[model samples]
Target: MNVYMKEQEIKTKLSAWVAGQSSGYHADSVPFDLRIIEQRIITSVQIMELILFLEHLRGEPINPMQIKPGAFSTINSIYQHFFIEGQAYA
Candidate 1:
């Protein structure tokens, strides 16, 4: 698939997974609206969790090193990292 289509697909899957994780924590903590927390507070642990979850959903092995600073900074970044850089399941 083309990059745009691939990014969209990844976004959809990531949204679902994030929603699930959010619900697991609190009913009101929607993953998409994490704006309540300052961006500076977003730790590597959280990013790593997201990376592992996405990798699991794609039936691929998780690679923490692939999730670099610019890569896991945002949802879009995650998509770019895995699809464009890591090229997992591409």
Candidate 2:
């Protein structure tokens, strides 16, 4: 896994993407624990866009079989499941 990207950098990019998904948010102000999907901060269709963003960030394709809805529930969970070592419970 060439997941050598710094965690902060990854989170920054992720935050920017999520913030851009909404009109009233900013990258730095995006709450890590916010239930974006559940709150409709990001639309259902945007979920696929999020996945694609993550894939581009991680430089790899996420295994569809290993994905769970909980992994996409929030910014923090998404980072934990995809970028962090060992925390990727998939």
Tens digit of per-residue lDDT, candidate 1, span 40-73: 4345566667766777756677656544556555
Each model's lDDT: 0.58, 0.77
lDDT of model 1 at residue 62?
A: 64
Model 2 local distance difference test score:
0.77
In terms of lDDT, the best-performing candidate is 2
Clash pairs, candidate 1, are: none
- Those runs of model 2 whose alpha carbons end farther than 4 Å from true positions after fitting are 1-5, 85-90
lDDT per residue as tens, model 2, 1-90: 344557666777888899998989987878878888888898869987987888887777776567765887888888888876423532
How close is every model to the real structure, measured as TM-score? Answer: 0.57, 0.80
Q: Give residue 34's error in model 1 in angstroms.
A: 7.2
